[model samples]
Target: MFCGIVAGEVRAFRVTDEPDGVAFLDTRPVFKGHVLVVPRAHLVTLADLPPESITGYFGLVRRLAVAVESGLGAGGTFVAMNNRVSQSVPHLHTHVVPRTKGDGLRGFFWPRTRYADDPDATSYAERIRSALAADPA
Candidate 1:
């Protein structure tokens, strides 16, 4: 349970319990209906994951993307995996961010700016949670 995010039982769009670890969604998200497909086993980079797990992980990501796009009404979605360079957490996790025009979020091209405070983070997380709960994909 990293960061206490997994405090109790929660629902996931998809779940794959591998020998090494498990992967699921981030109930709190940056964008509406955003999902984080992560391995429960701690691995810093994609290269560290087992070959079969890597393959299955991406497969789940693809499915999650389709769900986010269809269920969340996103115009598009962004899927990404990170190594040490941009990895905030040591665990290997993939981000499935749902995108829309005029959401005030620029694409990956633009530099990211920090939110004002906890309220901003809470607001964003709440919006995504509500959307996902209302219409899960």
Candidate 2:
């Protein structure tokens, strides 16, 4: 799944200028502004990611978390990941889901949603990308 996105074989609404990873909207989103940041390399889990790459990879995650909040006007963000046990895809991808007060989202068992169409998802991608570009840190 992620391999296809990294290879441009899959159609993903992508956020440009990702430093050490590829940024794109998640197909099943916890919220409207949910984004998935995945390393360019095919690392199956955090254990597979090399030590030297950790900082850069997490730097991108931090930026995306900020971008998701500011871009979507969310109160905050829910940034997390699943390892080998609950891993849906065999890729080390971090999920950055936008959060708002009283949005009814609770814990890891919250429901997910799909964008109405590509245009809708593209709007989110554009917002996050613009925010990411504007972010100097």
The candidate maximizing lDDT is 2
Over 1-137, each residue of candidate 1 has an lDDT whose tens digit, in order, gives 43233322544433334333344445555654556767656567888888878666676566667666765678988888779986777767888877887777655552344445556545544544454455433
- The residue-by-residue lDDT of candidate 2 on 1-137, one tens digit each, is 99899888999899853549998999899888899999999999999999999999999999999999889999999989999988899999999999999999987786989999989999999999989989949
Give the TM-scores of the predictions, in the order they appear: 0.61, 0.96
Error of 1 at 87 (Å): 1.2
What are the lDDT figures for the candidates, one per model? Answer: 0.60, 0.90
Every model's Cα RMSD, please? 5.9, 1.0
lDDT, candidate 2, equals: 0.90
User: Model 2 segments beyond 4 Å from truth?
Assistant: 17-19
Candidate 2's TM-score reads 0.96
How does candidate 1 score on lDDT? 0.60
